[model samples]
Target chain A: MKHNPYAALPATVENIIVETSNITTFTFRPEEPIPFKAGQFVELSIPGFGEAPFTPSSSPAVNDVMDITIMRVGAVTERIHALSKGDTVGIRGPLGQPYPLDKFKGKEILIVGGGVGLAPLRALFFALAEEMDHYKKIILRYGARSPGDIVYRNDVATAWGKPKVDLMLSVDKGDEGWKGNIGVVTTILEKNKLSINIQNSVAVVCGPPIMMKFATIKLLERGYAPENIYLSMEKNMSCGIGKCGHCRIGPYYACKDGPVFTYDRIKDEPRIWD
Target chain B: MAKQLKQGCTINGVIEFLTTGCRVYALSQTDSNYHLTSDEKWESDRHMLGPHRPVEPLKSILFPPRQGVGRLLEDAPHSSPKPAAVIGVKNCDLASLKIHDYVFRDTEPKDPYYIDLRNNTLIISCDCSRPCDVCFCTAVGDQPFPESGFDINISPLPNNQYVLESGSEKGKKALDSCSDLLEEASQDAMKARDTARKAVYKTVEEQAAVKGLDGNKNYQNAVTGSIESHLWERFAEDCVECGACNFVCCTCHCFLLADGRSATGTSERVKQWDSCLYKNFARVAGGANPRKYRAERLYNRFDKKFNFFKKVLNIYACDGCGRCIEACTGKIDIRDVLKEALDEA
Candidate 1:
């Protein structure tokens, strides 16, 4: 029998966590365990509705259960948000290039995420936590629209906290009760605010396209080498195996060569920010 | 390497040989163009292979326009019929299998759907006698006739026969099964076919040069450098996003998956032809569309064919089939765009 790259395995929605008004975290239990690296994504199916590509928010360590943090943005996502617990859905993946964990060993790791883009980072967060002693430090600078838009609010500190981890949170518009800074995420990357060794630190960024573009420039300004900076180049990876031809960034497919490419690798590629 | 000639060969004889266990399709003359279809009754000699490729792309055969690529909820037994023999395939379409193979089969986790059909299908190519007005194969480092890459090539001779040459092991085996329909080729016939191929090549080269579409000029440099140029905006003015150029070009292999049902009415996913020319081709789930402007999409088409593929595979994706020039109702000529881009640089 020919191997069908598009074949989806059965995965039941085990739980749902409403992260925000628009974003939700879905925990699915696959019939077969899917082992994946941190930054790789999966194509979650809604049976009759169709499928959408999403990065897993759950730990790569856990194989049977997977958490996908998704926001209601389109037809497939709209139907995905409507899926209740115990609903069966088809899933295909562990696709695309994962974060370069081997390269980050013995170095400081700075994770920058915006809005729902923190989903794939959460997976990386867990993977790095498992080997927290391997790296020098882990710093996360995350921002959202407002206090209400913050994801994993219930246990971000408990789950992401470590001895060497420095976590910073911010919002574009803060409420009266919001004691944190009220500014964009790039503002947090200022000279006085961040105290990482520029040569020792590597930055991994994921977020909206505009946020990513600005964050990359900020990281560059902070003396982060283009090779030291990794970007999650999320295009419309229509076919997760790179056959669909939608996620082409220059000659590379985001589905195959990346979705986790270093800034230096794709700096010359055409319209990357787009 | 199996070259043979049939003294009294007919198109029906070729069709009859191919129709034993597989479905055979040949181009049926439709006005000045041709449509590839299985004919119940072919006209006396079926000489309507046409001077160039059909308006309908060859990709529509192997990688179907629409297919139910289902991930069945329930375990179901699957079966697919094996073979199809497509006749009178032009060199442009034949050469384009390189692009399709690279995208669908040469890459990792190969597309089972595309590979299945492509492997099962047999190509019976023919030497083109004349070039169409839209054709510019010589410009893109190609010839009117297929030098290689065909299973079997039929070059028409003056004696109302054809010299059949097998270019693949499959063609050699296929010829063995149908040896009764063929005769040994004379050295004179082989020389005649070679002479005819060269004559058409010269004519095509002269025609392409006249339009300024023929050259060894670096399309990669021109197209990649002109990303910020107003050339795209100017050309996009004449463009209506009909996607006829994408559909007609054999190299355009982009696709989109949608929801659909199979014949059993069971739930399934449908993967169909998609175009970069489409407004939302690069749009994600979010309201963000990278190629929002028509000009961006137009520029992207050239960038992929000229810059992207050239940098990666060292081959321009365009075969100069000129189907796009014919298919465009907006009358946006690709040759004119390339010429202008080269001139600007």
Candidate 2:
């Protein structure tokens, strides 16, 4: 029998982690292992509640379980946020192209993220750490609304807390006891805390459209080539396939050609920030 | 295999033959629109061949407006339906089908539902012997005849007679099966068919030339250049968000999948047609809307048809059937919009 392309494999929520007030991460164990490289997305469906496209927040190396970090934003997401451990859902994916790790082999990598945009970056981070010695160094600059809004707080600080890794973090605002950077994530980039060879470095950015807009400008000003700057773009991707024309950005379908794209490739397209 | 002529075959005979094993839906002209109907007999007095494409797209029949794709909790619920034959299809509609074929068939992880229905369905197309006032197919580098992508083609002669030519083996068999109702096409009828084709092309070509739509065939450059133009703002002034243009358009394929409960109380995921003109079409979660303005949505529709598809498929998605011109209550003419947008500084 020909397989149903829209049929999502049944999955059970194995674990749940509260990242922030609105954002939470759910680890799901599906009927079949959903193997995906970093930067790829999946359609997560709640039974009878509809589906939404989300990037798997877990490492591709992990075979049995996949992680999805979601924010309570829309109707389907509201139900997904209400899901607890042992709750059954659906998953259809390993869709879209993964981040081209092959191109970043000998280059210094700058990973920048904002808000819950850190989810897909978290997956890419794990993939990059698995092969730490292959690259020169890793510079990660992440920002959120406030200190409390930071995701994977413990992991972000300690996971790559090695000699070659410079994990710089900031927030839009700070609480009383906050001692790290107290400005937007771009402020950290302005400080240039880490010594990155701009000519030999490729920057990967993900976040809200506003942050991505400024971060891209900041990266370009910092002598990074447009081709070297990677972005994880998001729009309303209903089918998670090219058939649906919803997530179209210029000639490329965000669902098919990319949720991940280079700044140079799409700079001339209209309304990049929007 | 030769052009087994069906000289005096009436549309009734063709519809009668097509309705044998499968269902048949032939286009019946209402006062203003052309819609497919499955009545026992079609309009005999009116010309059998279409002057242009019907306002209702062929996508509505092949892909369906709304259908259950699969179940939310249970096994895959619905199966693809039995084959059905559609008649009164114009060349513009056939061009629209090519875009659908590329999207649903040539793209990755082929749509099983679309593939099943299209594979089983036979296409019986007709040439547009006359151009509708709104039609500009010749302006956009497309002819008023079916060059390919059909089982059989019916070129109309005077007196409601048709010269049936088979495009596929199935069409040949269909003609052979209805041999009793047909005769060899005469030399006069063949010559008349060629004359009618040129006449219609001339009419549309002249209209396009007068409106300056013929030379500005490079739509990609026009739309991309005027991304920030004020013309879209003016075009969207009288717009009510009815999305009739999308519904009438032959190549618009945006869809939304919503979970709904069926009559049996079983929940299913239904794929339904969606329009980019709506406020929420490209809106994502967390309230960030890319196309929040009506002007942006309006521009997006043109950009997809003229620029996006041209860059990807090397063909403009608009076949210039001009169904959108009649369907829009706002009275927005697409030809005028393209002409003005192309000339916009």
lDDT of 1 by residue, B57-146 (tens): 788888888886654565534567468778888988888888898888888898777887887877888888887777888888777888
Candidate 2 lDDT tens digits, A1-274:
3667778888999999999999999999999898999999999998777899999888889978998899888999999988889999989988899999999998889999999999999899889889988888889999999989999988987866877788889988899978898888789888456568999899999999999999999888888889999998889899998878888888899988899999988998778788
Q: In terms of docking quality, how is candidate 2 classified?
A: medium
Residue B78, model 2, lDDT: 57
Residues B1-345, model 2: lDDT tens digits: 323245555566665665566656677678866766654334445434456677678888888889678887567755656667777788888888878999888888888888888877778888886677888888787888886788888887677767778788887788777777776777777888888888888888888777778834788888878878899999999689899999889989888877777778777887899989999998888777789999999999999998878877888899888889988999999998888878983
> What number of clashing residue pairs does each candidate have, in the order they appear?
0, 0
lDDT of candidate 1? 0.84
State the iRMSD of every prediction, in order shown. 1.6, 1.4
TM-score per candidate: 0.96, 0.95
* CAPRI docking class of candidate 1: medium
Best by TM-score: 1
